[model samples]
Structure formats: structure tokens, C-alpha cells
Target: MKVTVIVPARYGSTRFPGKPLANILNKPMIQHVYENVSASTLVDEVIVATDDERIKSVVEGFNGHCFLTSKEHATGTDRIAEVARNLSTDIVVNVQGDEPLISAELIETLIKPFQDDEKLQMATLKSKIKNQEDVTNPNVVKVITNKNNHAVYFSRSTIPYNREKIEVDYFKHIGVYAYRKSFLFDYINLPESILEKAESLEQLRAIENGHSIYVSEVSNELIGVDSPEDIEKVEKFLKAR
Candidate 1:
């Protein structure tokens, strides 16, 4: 299957405005994310799908492929669906623009689920939450999976309510997602379900609609720039390594 990475970058953000344009070292944050995905051998090509012209220009300045999507898109997945509609690739990986430190190996790992199983329509990554603070934090979304490694549910609330034990292994959901090209169109059209609306997670719509999502456990903790302070953390990480 031809795997292409599509990054949905928007200039306007409620928490941190102009998040995509924020400088990390010398380059824009989105550019760093684009370059990281571009370096991956698993991805056939990387495209920046955005509504802003400035974001398009920044991507093009670095000689990267970009597409101007409609501003009406309610979510990142919806924006990615627009780009997927025009592309001929079999698989589209929706890499978040905020995560500049996303590893190429993690992209490769997400792509592997398709090779192993044709039944999986979508796939995402997760890591076991070891910290006690993370377990109770609503900001950190947790996941519970079935025996087959298919996700049963995803939520901000701690899953599996451990009445018996205080420390059962908790898995935090990572935002990176991979979807089959054909499924992308259908996913966007699906109406939001109660669980989805309550959780504010777009992926839950797929689950509620009876689609399967395979989970891959990744070791790396994805560092995403949610606020201006996070830029320094990413810079220090990059410089140290």
C-alpha cells in the first residue's frame, strides 16, 4: 500500500494562537513536523493540509507539498479527509502538526498494523501511563483495549475503574492516527454519536459505528506544543539529542 502522511495545520488556535507558525529554534513548528515525517522511509509523501495561505507559503518555502483545504472543517481529521479525497494513495497517515518530535520509527510502527491485518480500518498508538499523577489527570486521555489489542474505548476519565487495585496498567491515547484511504471519506460523513460528543473525541464516532481500531504501543512520549512554554521544552530536547 502507498502510505502518505497528511499534516493538518491551522494558524488559529484557542489555547495558543499562531501555533503552527511558532518558532522552534529557527524553523516554524509545523515545518519541523513536516521534516520529521518526510524523513520516514515508510511514508511515500508528506502533504500539509491547511486553510491559511501563510501556512501554505511556509510549507512551500521549504519545497514541501501542500493543499489548501476548506475553512469549514470542524476537526483535523476532516481537513485530512479533504486531502485524501484528491490523493491516489491507499493509506493516509494523519500526523498532528503540534508534535515536532514525532519519531519516524513511530510512523513505521503505525503503518505495520495494515500489513499484519487487513480488517483494521484505522490504527493509533498508546503508552502505559506509569505516573500516578497522569492516571488521575483528565488532560491525559486513557484507553482500554480488548484481548485482540483493539481499543474498547477512549476517554479523559481513567478507564476500567480499578475498585480492586489502585495501580492497574493505564494506557494513554496518543493523537497520531492512520486510516485507510477509503475509510477516510466515510469517517468524515459519520454523524457524531453521544459518546463522541461527550468525550469530544472524533475517533469515538468510528468505535460507536462498529469499526475496528487497532492499537500499537509506542515507547516514546510524544511532545506536543500546546502552549508557548512547550516550545522551550522541545528546543532543549532537540538540542540535547
Candidate 2:
């Protein structure tokens, strides 16, 4: 399959403005994400989809490809859908701009489901929840999968309740997503479902609409930078490696 990795970046953020331009180890955070995603053998191309010229300029400064998108886009998926609308690739991977520590192998794992099942429309990664705090944290989205490895539901609250068994394994949802080009366009038009609005997760809309989302289990721990405080953690991780 012809796959394109689109990193959605924007200068305006509620917590940290110019987050994509934030420097980590003397290099822009977006550059780190772009480079890591580019390492994937499955990806044919990587591009930054942003509405800000500053982000576009920085991406180009590093000799990376970027496309100027509409500023009115409410979500990163919307921005990616706009870019995917003009692309000719079969699969579009939405690599989150905030995740500077994204793994290429994990991305490759996400795309594997498509090759095996042509009927699969969307897919994402999930890792076992090791941190006790993450289980109850609203910021950390959790997922439950069926026996077939398809996502049954995604929620901020801990799933399965574990009333009978006190120690049940829980899976944390990874934000990275791979979508077929046709599904990408169809997803943007789907009305925001009640479950999605309740949980504040866009992926829930797909599940509510009868679309199957395959969840691939990965061992790597992925950290996404949502605020300025997260940069230090990411930097420490990079320095340790």
C-alpha cells in the first residue's frame, strides 16, 4: 500500500503556544517527530500539515515537506483530512505532532493490519497500562478490545470495572492512527457522536458509527507532549537513549 505520514502541527495551543517550534536537544520538536516517522519503511512520504507559516517555514528549513492548510480546522484529524484530500496515497497515517518520542516500529505495526485485512478502515496502537496513576487519569485514554483484536470501546474511565477480579489488565490507547484514504474523508463528515462528545475523543465516533478499528498491541511506551512540562521528560528520555 502507498502510505503517507502526515504530522498535523499548529502554532496556537491552549497550554503551550508554538509547541511544534519548541526546541528539544537544540532541534525543533516537530523535526524530531518527522524524522522518527520518516524512519518507518512502510511510509512512502512524510509531510507536515499546518495552518501557520512559522511552522511551515521551520519544517521547510529542515528540508521537510509541509502543506498549508485551513486555520479553521478544529482538530488535527480535520487538518489531515484536508491534506489527504489532495494526496493520491492509499493509506494516511496521522502522526501526532506533540509526540516527539513516537516509534517507527510502532507505526509499522499500526499499518500491518491493513495489509492483512483489506476491509479494515482504521487502526491504532495500544500498550499495557503499567503506571497506576494512568489508569484513572482522564488525560490517559483507555481501550478494551474484543477477542478478534478489534476495539470495543475507548474511554477515559477505567474499562471492565474489574469488580469480580481486582487485578485486570488494562490497555492504554495510543493517539497514533492509520486510516484508508476513503475512510479519512468519510470520517471528517461523520457527525460527532454522543459518546465521542462525552469522552472528548474523536476515535469514538468511528466506533459508534459501526466502523471497525483494529487495535495492535505494542510494548513500547509512547509519550506525547501536551504542555511545556512534557518537553523535559521527552528530553530526558532522548538523552538516556
Candidate 3:
């Protein structure tokens, strides 16, 4: 099955305007994400799905493929879905444009399972929470999975409630995801669910709709660029490397 990695970028950001185009070590941030994902041997194609012409131009400037979509999209999934609809790929991986330190190897790992499990419709990554305080942080979304690594629930509050205060392991959800072409459409078409609205998590839409999300535990030690300060961190890492 063919795999396509689409990095969804939007120029309008309330916190960091023109974030995708932000320069990191003299290169645009989107370029870093696109180049890293492109290095993945598992993927057949990489595209930047964006709503801004400026973003499109920057992507094209580096000879990378990019397509413009409707600006009204509420989420990156919606934007990538619009682009994937016209493609002939079987699997679509959503790689965030803000991840300058995104790993190509992890992208391969994200989609490789599709070859073995034909019934698997979706998959994502999870990291064990080493910091106890992060388990209680609202910004840190917690996920609980079943014995088969299928997600049971994802919430900002402490999952499984640890009411007994016993030692327990927690995993934080990573936003990246891969979906079968058919299931991707099925997901985008479904109305937002109550759990999704309550948690403000888009992935919950799939879980609430009775779809299982298989998660792969991965230790991804990288900083995601969210603002101008983040760029400095990315640059420092690159310089150190």
C-alpha cells in the first residue's frame, strides 16, 4: 500500500503568527518538517497542505510539493483530508509542521504496521510519563490503553484516577497519527462526539465513535516549535548536533 505524509500548516496563529514560515537556522520551520518526513523511506510522497499562499510559496521555494486548501478548516486533519482525497495513496500520516526535530525513522515506524494488519484503520504514538508532575499537568494529555495497546481513554485529568495513590505508569499522547484512506474519510465525516468536545481532543472523536486507535510506545526526545522561543531551542539543538 502506498503511504503519503502530509504536513498541515496554517498562517493564521493567534499565538505565533506566520509560525510555519518562521526561520530556524536560516531555514523555514515547515521546510525542516517536510525534509525530515521526506527522508522517511517508508513514505511514497510528502506534501504540505496549507491555507496560505505565503506558506505554499515557501514550500515550493525549496522544491517541496504543497497544495492550498480551504482556510475555514478547523483542524489539521480536515486540511490533510482535503488533500488526501485527490491522492491515490492508501495510508495518510499527519506530521505536524511545527516539529523541526521530527524523526524520519519514527515516521517509518508509524506507518509500517499497516503492511501487517490490514484491518488496522488508525495508529498513533505514546510516551511514558517520567515526570510525575506532568501526569497532573492539564497541558499534558494522558492516555490509558488496553492490554492490546488499544486506547481506552485520553484526558487532561489524571487517567485511571490513581485514587489509591499506588505507583502507576502513565503515557502522554503524541498528536501525530496515521489512518487508512477509507477510515480517514469515515472519521472526518463523523460528527464531533461528546467526549471529544468535553476533552477538546480530536482523536477522541474516533474513540467515541467506537473506532480503535492502536498506539505505539515511542521515546521521542525532541522539542516541538510552538513559538519564537522554541525556534531558539531548535537552533541550539541543530547547532549542537
Backbone clash count for every predicted candidate, in the order shown: 0, 0, 0
Q: What is the lDDT of residue 32 in candidate 1?
A: 90
lDDT by candidate, in order shown? 0.91, 0.94, 0.91
Query: Which ten-residue region of model 1 has the weakest summed lDDT?
Result: 159-168
Question: Candidate 2, residue 131: CA error in Å?
Answer: 1.0
What tens digits encode model 2's per-residue C-alpha lDDT throughout 146-234?
99999999999989788887768999999999999998989989999999999999999999999999999999997789889999999
What is candidate 3's lDDT per residue for 1-241, written digit by digit as tens? 8999999998988889999999998999999999999998888999999999999999999999999999899899999999999999999999999988888888877887788899999999888988889889998889999999899999999987878889889999888899999999999999999999998999999999899999888887567877788888889999999
Give lDDT tens digits, candidate 1, residues 1-241: 8999999999898889889989999999989999888888989999999999999999999899999999998899999988888789988999989999998889998999898877678999999887879888988899999999999999989788899887579999999999989888888899989999999888899999999899999888877899999999999999999
User: What is the C-alpha RMSD, rounded to one decimal, of candidate 2?
Assistant: 0.8
lDDT of 3 at 129: 89
Q: Which candidate order results from sorting by TM-score in descending order? A: 2, 1, 3
Give lDDT: candidate 1, residue 137. 90
Supply candidate 3's per-residue lDDT for 225. Answer: 73
Off by over 4 Å in 2: none
Ranking of all candidate structures by their lDDT, best first: 2, 3, 1
